[model samples]
Target: MPAYFQGLAIGLAYVAPIGMQNLFVINTALTQPRRRALLTALIVIFFDITLALFCFFGIGTVVERFALLQLLLLLCGGLIVTRIGVGLIQEEPTLDQSVEVDLPLKDVAMKACVVTWFNPQAILDGTFIFGGFRAGGVAAGESLQLILGSSSASFLWFFGITLVISLFRAHIGTKLLKAINTVCGAVLIYYGMGLFLDGVGRVQQMLSSLF
Candidate 1:
């Protein structure tokens, strides 16, 4: 396969998992107006590409070297995501056909930014996946192609997620929407806890080395 195609494949595989970003985008699409939701996806896509470029271009290795930085990132990200998850769980979207909630556009955009940029798994994906490709002896010309391919994957995935949600909106009533929010919240909490634990593990390792 061509380098570009290879990169595309790698990108798709990495983004396929249902993580914080995916859940947020899906939730946004379901809850918000179409234009705002689409804009939210676009913001996430922009960050996704930016991170990929940062990692593939060699900053990822530098990040990996700093165990302290990694620990900080994990802890911060865990706390933030966990808080979000808790909020979601606590504030179950009202299923009443009579009541509707409209989240502010800025709020949605801010959340999208936090979920993408502050997500440790997302950073890891960029570092490990894209960075791995870079280390695999890709030529300079092919490097650009790879970056483009990976970016395209983000574009496709975000839009595709919203599209799927939009398709089933009418079929999925308030009850089903509540169920989806609950599920997303649970998954995020689980994911965030894992990140926190990982950070703790790293701390233990650091102390062990120091002693």
Candidate 2:
């Protein structure tokens, strides 16, 4: 029981920050229909939970042990994230409520996956945090309970935010939405550039070591 609560708290702390996942969800809620927004939230939750599981189970160790893997992830994730940001910046927000601007379900899922799985920061952070907990004398049953609690947090936070945004979307003007998108897009591009630079530095170090 204590473990479960601990996991719940950690999970909220892990996810409550303004990041790619939250930005994507918020944008969907603002632009898409209520059903589509909720579905996007669900897709994000699925990816988040699976990512948590992967980190808790030992993927973190694998990433740590393999410099090549880390380099590839950084480079690929940066490119993809940067492209997504460019798209958001270019997108023109509409005031028309009658027009369906909803993306296809597959597109939603793909974006969710990229924002969750391709995020090296999220992966590395989750790996350290959850992996640390797993290494810290937790019993198997307790670990399971902890994971369940974390999953619950993802469910609660995404759905709650989506519903709230959907309700207030009427009050949100197109200008405000466009501003939000621009800001979020800039942030993402900055983050992506950092990742790409880090990847480049890693490559340089590897080459130096071999020489």
Candidate 3:
């Protein structure tokens, strides 16, 4: 496939992994109106793109290497991820609430950015997926191009979803919102467990090899 098409395929594959951050952004947009929700989505995109650049560079090496580092990250990060997933699953969606209390774009953006930056899967995707692709024979520009392409898919899905929600905001009640959260959270919990188990297995292997 051509580089552009390759980028598209890779991008879609890259963004397909579901997570809390995406769920929150989608939920926010659907619950809130244009300014606040779009700000949230844009914040997510900004963090994702910035992290992609960071991982593309040599910065991720420190984390990618060393079994101990992986363990550290998994133990701390995985727990956090699992917690967020559980939180989402437990949340009672309040879809009936009026879309009031306008949040400033800057503040909303900053919070969304922080939330996106801290999301462990964001790191994994940026570091593992994007980083791996770039490390391959692909040109640097092309690698970034691929990442941007992938990011676009995320942007499109998120914004597209928000657009639909905004259009039908009146109809989607708490039950539907709760169902969405439950599904997203269940998926996230599965991913978090996988991360935890993978790290545990690596540690076990490292120990076995020591003897």
Q: Provide the overall lDDT of each model, using Cα atoms, as 2-decimal numbers.
A: 0.82, 0.90, 0.70
Comparing candidate 1 with candidate 3, which one achieves the higher lDDT? 1
Candidate 2 lDDT by residue in tens digits, 87-197: 999999775878877787898899999999998888888988898888787887798889988999999999999999999989989899899999999999998888988
Of 1 and 2, the candidate ranking higher by TM-score: 2
Candidate 1: tens digits of C-alpha lDDT, residues 116-136: 789888888779888887888
- Please tell me which predicted candidate would have the highest lDDT against the true structure: 2
lDDT of 1 at 6: 82
Write model 3 residue lDDT over 12-128, tens digit each, in one string: 675555566667777687667666677677777676667766876754676777657667767666766676679878977665555384777777776566456656667766678
Consecutive 10-residue window with the lowest summed lDDT within model 2 = 93-102
Q: Identify the candidate with maximal TM-score.
A: 2
Name the candidate, 1 or 3, with the larger TM-score value.
1
Give candidate 2's TM-score. 0.95
Clashes of 3: 0
Name the 10 consecutive residues with the lowest summed lDDT in model 1.
92-101
- The TM-score of candidate 3 is 0.77
